[model samples]
Target: MILAIDTATKWTGLALYDGRTLLAETGWHSTNTHTVELAPSVDELLRRTGIQATDLAAVAVAIGPGSYTGLRIGLGFAKGLALANQTRLIGVPTLDIVAASQTYSEGQLVAIAEAGRSRVCAGLYQWRGKKGWQSQEPPIIDSWQNLLDSLDGPVIFAGEINPAAAKLIRAAGKSFQIANAMNSARRAGYLAEIGWQRLRRGWVDDPATLAPIYLRNPAETSA
Candidate 1:
């Protein structure tokens, strides 16, 4: 069984997955209460699932491109639980989880998340039946205009965007689909499922070395 947690943004979620099936799931808009709500949420999820920490095979967490504090809260809690239960830890990128929501597509997939100020964190991906969806390059920290300029063809856009972004996307005249509200936010169950598949394939990382995927340096001004 895998216990997954996502606190990369204001929307926080938790899930219990047993490789092939999701046993339980829960989430709420955190509203800056990550530190206070994380543990209790985990406890409630495990309780509701009738499972204990010791029964978990591993713990998966979304490790950023999001609020610094939110990332820390998730990673810290995940690491603590992994250490206490002697279970493995898997770090899935916040953007990758969002991208996975559209992995079924044959065209380009773009996953964007609101970056504070005026920029957005975006990544481009392509789907292949043999390898599934893979990122084309490192995620970019850019303004909505820059993102539009960089696009080459039809793309599926997923993330939190304002009216301006929506207008720009429409003006570009490129075919695109907006992810539904339920999927606009990261989903822990999806993260856990993907993490488990990767882990089985020997794609594992040291919990101690895991870190958030901040596309831009802290000193850089948001675009």
Candidate 2:
């Protein structure tokens, strides 16, 4: 089975997927409590699903463009599990998880993760038929206003969008669409699915060298 974890922001999530079934999934808004909440939650999920740590064939984690502490904790936990279990370690880009949750649109899809100081880490994506949404560029740090101003055509925005950001998108005019809450929330199930694909293709990362992708210095960003 593949175990997926995402602690990319204030939101954190976990899931178990065996390629054929999504056995379990859970997520919550953490008030900077990921350190205390993540491991126990993982244990509970595994226990409730009657799955043991040894049963994991691969451990997948969202590698940053997120908060320093959050990314470190998640990756450290995942890496420890992989090393201990001798399983594959898979790292999925954080924004790709957000983009995967949305339905296909003819226009562009912008996946975003909150970056403190009124900025967001954003990635542009396009649907790739059976392959799902593929990122068009590397994620960047930009304020909502500047991000909106940089877009020229109809676009669907997803991930970590607050009401204030939604209001700004609305004010940007009719060409922009904010994803619904359900689609906007990043879930580890999608992360698991993506990880499963990579695992099948032998694209796993070396746990010893794998590292988080931070668009800016983590010391200055909150994710």
Candidate 3:
């Protein structure tokens, strides 16, 4: 079984996946309460699924370009659980998790997560029939204008894009579609599926070396 957690923002999500199916999943949009609620939520999920920590083969978490406190809380919990259970821990980039939600798109895929101020953490991806979505540029923290200037063609935009950002995307003179915001929040089942794929390919990372991808320093302002 694979246990997945996402505390990348105000919303925290948890899920238990047994390779072939999702056993249980739950989430709450309580950013300020993660410190107190995360553990109980995890316990509730496991209880509902009748799975113990030691029964999990691995743990997956969203390592992010998100709220620093949220990332640390989620990662710390995941790492501790993995250590206690002697299971592998996997950290998936927040942007990649957002992109995975739109894996069925045939054209270019752009996953953008609100990065506070007027900037966003964005990644460009292209779907290949057999290879799946290939990232065009690694996730970067930048203004919506910068993202617009760099676009070459029609693209699908996914994640929590604001109205202003949406207008800019439309003005780029390219076909664009907004994916569901919930899809961007981090789906535990999807995280587990993706983690399983990476594990099979030997793409595991050392828990000690894993760190959240805060593309730009929190103190810096984007123009």
Ranking according to TM-score, highest score first: 2, 1, 3
lDDT of model 1, residue 205: 67
**Error in Å for residue 173 of model 2:** 1.2
- Give the higher-TM-score candidate: 2 or 3: 2
| Ten-residue stretch with the least lDDT total in model 1 | 214-223
lDDT of each: 0.81, 0.92, 0.79
Highest TM-score model number: 2
Show where candidate 3 strays beyond 4 Å: 180-185, 218-223
Q: What tens digits encode model 2's per-residue C-alpha lDDT throughout 1-223?
A: 9999999888899999999999999989889888899889999999999999999999999997898888999999999999998889999999999998888887899999987788998999998999788999888998999999999668999999988999999998858988999999999999999999999999999999999999887679774
Which is the winner by TM-score between candidate 1 and candidate 3? 1
Clashing pairs in 1: none
Q: Which pairs of residues collide in model 2?
A: 114-223
Candidate 2 structure lDDT: 0.92
**Tens-digit lDDT track of model 1 for 77-175:** 999999999988899888888877664765788888767677788888888777666888888878888888878667878766667888888888767
lDDT of 2 at 43: 95
* Model 3, CA-based lDDT: 0.79
Summed backbone clashes in each candidate are 0, 1, 0
Worst 10 residues of 3 by lDDT: 214-223
lDDT of 3 by residue, 115-136 (tens): 7677787888888777677777
